[model samples]
Target chain A: MHKIALIFGHNDYTFEIEKNIKSHYKKIYIFNLDGQSVSKDSNGYEIEAFDLSEDWDELRDSVNIDECEAFCILEDMSKNIFLTLSLRETFKNLKIVALSQDKESTDKLILAGASKILPTTQTTANIIVEMLKKPMITEVLHNILYEKSNVKIAQIIVKNAQYFDGLFASDINWSKDYNITLLSVIDENGDTEFIYSAKAKHQQIKNGYQFVVVGFERDIIEFEKLIGGADE
Target chain B: MLKSLLLDAAYKINTSKNYTKTKHFFYNLLENSNYKYKKVFDFFMIALIFSSVFILIREVKSHVNDELLFYNNYVVSVIFLIEYLLRFWISGSITEVIIKQSEHDVMFGAEFNLSLALRDIFYQKIRYIISVKAIIDLLAILPFFHELRLLRLFILFRVFKLFRYAKSIQVFTSVVAAKKFEFLTLFIFASIVVFVSSVLIYVMEANNPASPINTLFEAVYWSVVTISTVGYGDITPITEAGRVVAIFVIIAGIAVFSFTTSLIVTAFTEKLDEIKDTKLIDDIAKKREFYLICGYENISKEVAKKLVQNSEVIILEEDEQKAIQAKKDGFFALHYDPGSIESYRKLRINIETQVKAILCLSHSDVENVYTALTVRSFNKDVFILSILKAKANRNKLLFAGVNELLYEKELVGMIAKEFVGKPVAFEAIHALRSNYNGIDMQEIIINERIIESFKAVADLECHKHRIILLGIYKKNKRNFYFNPTYDTSLEVGDYLLLIGNMQFIKEFTDNLHKGK
Candidate 1:
């Protein structure tokens, strides 16, 4: 589980963000300026809380440095920088993930030693807009990727594949030879379709067949050499 | 005559494409330029793509039904046979296509000397990415022995297919790609969940009465269903003690889902409002000895892309982020943002000549605008481009005598619309009206050394290749214009801010510099 420190601008940002990221992380500490946003999670791991920005010297006196982990600056830019910078000076190993209102804020946050500058809201809408674009492709690709798989979805183009060109699936000894399973092909005209039969074994595949495959990394690399073509 | 010839060439490149040309060429060759043959070819290719999909669906069914497997194999094989025959019938030369990719005589170095015509056939140098997808297309058809083992497995690929069909999925995928480092950890976490849960369930319930949970497969199934909160209950444990352990498993399930969601959220949030996939060139006008500054970040990249491309951009950014972005794009940039008076003095402006523009592209537009104002007080002739973040502060920038002001949010939106548009526009624009996490602008340079000449620019065949010239800023002349015509001469020094078809970006770049 990823360790995340949730810093709030007030209480709301901390509360909402912690609720969202709570499920994904192993441990999350939600802290507002008031130092009391700790809520019971549905799971057993109770989110810890703290707020040093409110009473710097005193709060700094109370919190234990050794117990803390990476931080997520969910609050507004200023307090996010102040608390995060203070936190950084001591717990240098703590990953600082801060949110920025815009580019200027992103710069300030970076100088203050925040590891990543979150663009805050523009990307969210872009994602929505991106979704509205060619939704079918998105749907198909997501289903393919999100599924449980020890294997990665990859493609290999048949460049100058001499041995496998005319050979069909039944004909080419992939299991014995390449150790990569040939899955599909995309033609020169940008048409992608499934490989049908052993017949493809005898007749050579036309130019531009990008083979979809699943296999060990070593064989995939070898197949990529044959199909993905020269990077040039 | 030369001008007219150039114009004619431009027209030819713009009006036709290889796809269209090939279609026409085939029709003419068959001596059936009339309507009949055209329809036939279209239907044939369409059938191939569509039928493959059908075959895949049928094979999915065959996986569960043993008797149906025979028919699936037969039907699939027949389709492959027909596809092969049709390709041979259509293509003029089959051997040339396959053999042309990997034939290498021999290369002594790491870079394979695959360019020579007489290279060996076994290693036909694969030049196109389409070929990899071709193999995938083929694999999608050939019925594997998978269904005989597990039916739930088919849902896996079908889901991927759904995402593949949507535009949002493309954006989602890009956001994921941008944060691949972060996502990899999540993936590893997911893998551990599946692996550890399986072991845990097996160890905990091996002798239990409720669910034997003997096989690793059942453990995997139970884990997935439980984590997803589906709780199919087909393989539930009957033992009371096992129930206690199951609660912990369910909790793990919730954590996994929550974790995965945040990963997507983080990636999307970072990518929002970003003005990505465009190159900036100085605006075209009479040269006033402008200095081109090529680098940008929040201040550097944002402002450089916002200003006119035709001007001499003496890009200054000490940050490696900005410097690297500039170098990868082939635009000239100095490594420094002249924000401070000391930095300005350090520029060592010949003062007498050669420098007539000062663009303070730093993170804060306020700082940049002020820097411009500061620079102008000393050298009034220098045109300054400032990067200011707030729209409310436009007057302040103008008061600074900045020739132009680039608002990161606004510029990101405009650049985004130009590069990857239709579904997604300027992230800045989207964010103001929509629920965007943030907006940013990025660069997509037409790589150096792809085509021998600027012929690719004139050819207009790039769109097919999925690279678009959103705006062309002629570096030599210091002129930039939006959506340049097909004939726009693309010199080595020129930078094109383009929105590449994100999916094909890798393919396009792979073809840029011959691999070595």
Candidate 2:
């Protein structure tokens, strides 16, 4: 179970973010930006209020970032950058999903200690690419990602795994071995392609939405289990 | 299991490893599509239908060996028969075999059935004329069946069948037939002019030899050409009386021409211009206010409208060229591919952050999901109403942080039940649709005493103004539930979504505001 911190700007969006996160991570702390017209009544969700202008120490002490698996700032890059820097100083291994307002903010967000800086522009572009390629498959994708009934979109960026490369999708059998399903790929170019390679017994580095996937919440635990077994 | 079996069967019929080969086979055998060679074939058929009949007639009269023409006639007849059979086969008319299909088709069936019948009771019907023409054509080729000489003579009415090849001629004929009584009244008035002109021209041109107008027919011909402005100068009266007649005729010609043209043009141009300008775009900003451009790809038009309920939209379009056209169509347009977060920024999407959410409709699963993903990445808190195009993409977008998901197809289907049949629903909704082009159809609930009395939601929205109530989609979900009465009382925020013409919709809104 990843301990994640989600900081959002709007009520509805915050509510949705929480709902999305609840499926993937058992523990999540959501913080909403102050002074927006959104409220509990207007927005369909309860937003955990937080001031963006708060001192770094105050924010850290308030949110407790030291123990989190990931810190996601679903807001403008400048604010996200501040949060990333604040969180990085306390927890160096913490993965950050820092939302970038524009492409210009990406490099700075990374420099500010974000492990993952998802620029809004790139996400939207990759979305379009995915839609154009497999036009109607997004419905199935949404069913898994948004609904808490069974699945979640989790990412384990291929790194330091010699055995991970050159394996077909079917052969991966992540569901059987690790209780996860590979939904799509997000390539290095910010392009997204759906992973429908049922015959694919091998996998390669294909950057796109095709690499992103729906998997059981326990898949990450399964991954950690394998890691523990390897260590022993 | 049944669904899978059907899908497998459909897949076997349609899909192929080599698409080109499959396409060719289907194109030649099933489709019989004349797409690539349309222009060439259309002209060829036009020439063949008329020229062949002409040749057959002339050749048989000259006694220049009849079998070829007869054989050609039968071959063309067989082709028509085959074509008609294919049309009937594909139309699946058996499935559509209700008692009252097209009267025209039924009439045609009656004529054919009657002509072939031994008693020939079809000859008693008014449509029997068509049967007679077909009979004549059959007779024209009867040399193969050892029929006598009366078979080859084609009547003037038989030429009408060739009019099917002429669209303009068919329109002319139909119009002429419809205005038969009016034409008769016009004929009486025209004849009076003809008679007066004849008498006057006779008195004046009696002294002139070059333009001798001694007869009524010559005078009538001149009168018609001058009045109609055809003015083919084959025959005319040259005397002073003729000049007087010509002036009256020429003026009449211009008047008649203008009258006919005005009537037709005025009747059709209003709807035609509206259709021409009607186009689909994702976004358009009105009055510098941000708006959501909704598409089924990921959004519903209704929800899109709801998302931006009292806000203006700088309608962002997926294509810049489409945006330009939308601009020309009187929309405040912004060009940005909603799927591309970069396009949003590059197109100054954030520059006008005053925009309401770009409600990616959930019904358009792919587009809605993509738009949501991209949009959340940009402004995590922006309200995005997504319409799930299908049930599958719903959860994914919900996870992606879509504010709302409204299914348009399901909505339209649900509303269709309110109508007895498709025709009634279409006619009622057409006004609503027309208002959306450059104009909008928005219905609001008014509690002020200025407007007329209202008990039910429909009364407040549709009863007095008679704007077509598309539905009663409440804003209570977005706001507080002010009007909780399931029976009637519309509270402040509850909206009455009605569709009406632009003028009426505007007037209706203004009245609601004024408390009228």
Using DockQ as the measure, the top candidate is: 2
- Here, model 1's chain A TM-score works out at 0.47
lDDT value, residue B414 of candidate 2: 24
Q: Score the docking of each candidate (DockQ).
A: 0.01, 0.01
Tell me the tens digit of each residue's lDDT in model 1 across B294-334: 23553344334334344454566667676767767665554
lDDT per residue for candidate 2 within A67-141, as digits (tens), equals: 554445445556767766766766677666565645667787888788755444443333332332222233333
Task: Name model 2 segments beyond 4 Å from true.
Answer: A1-6, A20-232, B1-48, B56-63, B68-158, B165-192, B206-211, B232-234, B257-516
Q: Write the per-residue lDDT of candidate 2 for residues B1-516, one digit (tens) a residue.
A: 643453344445445556546445434443332234533544554665566566657775486555656545566555544433443334222212222222334577752221233132333232333544344434333433443445444322235445534545644555555556756666676667767766676667756777656666676767777777798988776766678778887776787767666545554454443323222221221124454564332122222333334555445567556667656655545556677877665443453345544645323477667777877776887766654545556689799888665543233322221111222222222322333233334546545453345555534444345333433334546332212232556555455544444566677777666652
lDDT of 1 at A11: 39
TM-score for all predictions?
0.27, 0.41
Ten residues in sequence with the least summed lDDT for candidate 2 chain A: A192-201
In angstroms, the error of model 1 at B152 is 18
> iRMS value of model 2?
22.1
- Which regions in candidate 1 have their CA more than 4 angstroms from the true location? A1-232, B1-124, B127-132, B140-169, B212-214, B273-516
